[model samples]
Target: MNQRPKLRSPPPSSAASSPSPPTSPNLNRDKAKTIIKMPRKSYIKPTLVLASLLTIFALYTFLFYTPPNYNNNSSNLLNLVNKFDTNNSNVNKVKIYMYDLPRRFTYGVIESYAAARGGGQVEKDALLKYPGNQHSAEWYLFSDLNRPSESRINSAVTRVMDPEDADLLYVPFFSSLSLVVNPIRSANANGPADRPTYNDEQMQEALMEWLEEQVYWKRNNGWDHVFICQDPNALYKVIDRVKNGVLLVSDFGRLGRNQASLVKDVILPYSHRINTYNGDIGVENRKSLLFFMGNRYRKEGGKIRDLLFQVLEKEMDVIIKHGTQSRESRRAATQGMHTSKFCLHPAGDTPSACRLFDAIVSLCIPVIVSDYIELPFEDVINYKNIAVFMDTTTAVKPGYLVKSLRRVSTERILELQKELKKVKRYFEYEDPNGTVKEIWRQVSSKLPLIKLMTNRDGLIRLQNSPQSCYKISLYIENLDYQEPATTYFGEKPRPAKLACTIISMS
Candidate 1:
């Protein structure tokens, strides 16, 4: 109570006593000065300012701007875009003029096969379908050429309707299929009078006859034409007739050095028969050390297959089977390749076969045994990285191949598997950038040489003389060409100047 009584109001300071009259003019003036001194509130926002500027600029552009005349500047625009756009550029494409051959040479062959196989009356679109065989490269190429231009925009070869604009001529004859479907007979063989059986020889003769009638074939003597004879015996009757053209082949095995050479021909990988392995590269799941499931007995360079079989059949951790190409056999082969560390790719009827591509797609390291083998796309693919090459002598030696494969470290096997996976797409025929495109690219690469040889056809004539015998030696080093043999010509030999080889006559 005493403390409360002691608490008294203190004297008011000047500010407290100066509670100025509310309506005073001086107070109002002071209030106005205080309000003016205070920092001004910013009504203008940065976002609003930017939006207003953009709107004005957009209006100005829409009112004043005009687009350039596309018709006048199209080529320049295309050049500029293509110069920058590497994906859709057609700079390296080869313009091809595919012959509109009679159906008897193309679809008729497939139709005959379908009838033979009990697949009656093939659909018009089903002409693209052919028997799944190593020789199907012809079918793939034909099918690719037949596709719409828009669909093949990125393809290495563009089908041009105008023959004058064509860089190369494509013969759409299904030579391989014709050989497979029709019976083999000598051209002079007799058949029933009522209905003469269509034979491979007759087909070959007919194809050559039709080809000879073509203006392009006559103009270039088939030097700029491309003929696919993948099978060893395909187009056998007319091999020499079409020798001047680019031969799409699996190998130079059955062909004579003069008929097909690496200089003028393109080697294509056989379409793989087995399912591709989709798993990552690893050794943990693979159980077998070596696997080979193909015909043990083969002819020519393929004789090594029998010898390798005799040696590898009894070896431990090896699965070598002499099996034909049945559905069950393919299944077995697929399983064997997928789980095997190394797949043996011994030569079959030819120096190379689909088995090598199968091994590649299966991600199985390939043990290539053919000495005379000329691989497809050798320019781009380094085979040594993904495959183990062995000469016939070394591979056939008992215990040599097995011992060598066993010596390969786990690290090395993994490396090979990785490389196989990387290159697997190149051998796949169905892939957009695979075998078909690569084959076209290979053909495109030969365009300059094809043009040069085509232009130089009748420019030079070498005559044989008794006084001075000129030896026209053309050597293709490291390829599977026969040794140079002397031929005493009664008259002048055809001009043998090739773009890829050095031809010298002395």
Candidate 2:
């Protein structure tokens, strides 16, 4: 009886229970239907990306702002290394070159070098870094028979650069050999300070300035020696146009030399030399002084030589080189002049021009021959600083030169010595490296000087001597002081534009 009751209920299977639930409807049961699920994010991906970023960041943090690597082989990477390997071998550590004025030109070069023990202190103008003494210069650079640069002259002037290396090269313009300085910045072309752009114009102007120095080496009578017998108060323009004329003691020489051309440019018509301010002059000493300048003057084919043999006694304790002296003698002359208390500075044909830097090198006060002569750096440097200016017009006249000597006293001489000592404290040599470093900075930054790249046509490649060179002054303006960690040479002041004027010399 328990089993029989179940047979009646089996009648509805759906085919038996409910029409078999349509096949489609069964597929839509939702529970048994597979859901389109999104894949889970990969933990390895985000973790791996973060790990890679951290590793890179850490490595970068350690390497970049560290000390610049020195190629171990080149301890002094700045200067050239000789292949004593061969005497004729020519290899430059610094591709760029520099040239300085001859040692005979500046006594300060030797004194400064000797004092610094070879460039240990700082220079005022900062045009040079090394002691800039000639001996220190030659020791490491010109040690080999051939003279050369001490460091590469960087085109981009930024921070101070190292000394350049060289053996020798010709600088046709100045007609002398000089040194070159270039500092290679691993990151910046202009080390730390930005440099100005230079063009052919700048190069040409610089060359012109260098060329003007030829007036020094040229013989005094080169242009037939035009002398101006001028009145102290006379107009300067009156004699500006005198080309090839000689001025004699007679006033007629001044009146006739510039006829029609420079004849009447004077704002004032008269000349006088009676300054009441200057006090009494010693008669004997004045006469003696005039005799030293010129005992007799005679025109020899438009040239004049002082016939002062009787009075040309060597009183300066220095030697003189008259275009005919040995190299050693010439060097000695420079050193001698530097040691003297006063050096004669007979002005050239012109009245007040700027060629006095030469006189400064010797630490000797310039005993100027021209009253009209004015110094360029008159303020920063006092005439009283290192000079004994005399009026040439007054000295040239009757008994006037003698009177000038009377004005000078032992106290004045002592004062000159004090000033000379102060001057000696500073080193004044044409610092080729320092100047070029400045040039490099300018060229690297500005847009205009793109044309004048480092072309070594006139560069002198020489043997390298190991020595520290320049310490450049870095000028940073409006700099943010945050983190002083990252170094940067901001934009530099543009260099004065080079203006080229070609004067075809005949």
> lDDT by residue for model 1 over 33-92, one digit each (tens)?
999999977867987999999999999999999989888699898867755545543466
The superposed Cα distance between candidate 1 and the true structure at residue 3, in angstroms, equals: 99
Writing each residue's lDDT as its tens digit, candidate 2 over 1-506 gives: 45554444435444444454446766666635455454566799889999999999999989885766678547654344332313423332212222344442233333333332323333542343433222132222222112332233222311212213321121211111112122223564333243322232333344435534644212221122222222321222323322222221112323443341222111111111111112121222221222112113334211112412222334232222243224564454454444444455554333431123334444445566654433322223466656766554443455443345546776776676466545432223124433223322222332221112111111211111111111111222234445332322233333211011111111
Model 2 TM-score, all chains together: 0.28
List per-prediction Cα lDDT, in the order shown: 0.82, 0.32
* TM-score versus the correct structure, for each prediction: 0.73, 0.28
Best-fitting candidate, measured by lDDT?
1
Off by over 4 Å in 1: 1-92, 122-128, 182-196, 461-506
Top-scoring candidate (TM-score):
1
Instruction: Give the root-mean-square deviation of each candidate in angstroms.
Output: 18.6, 27.8
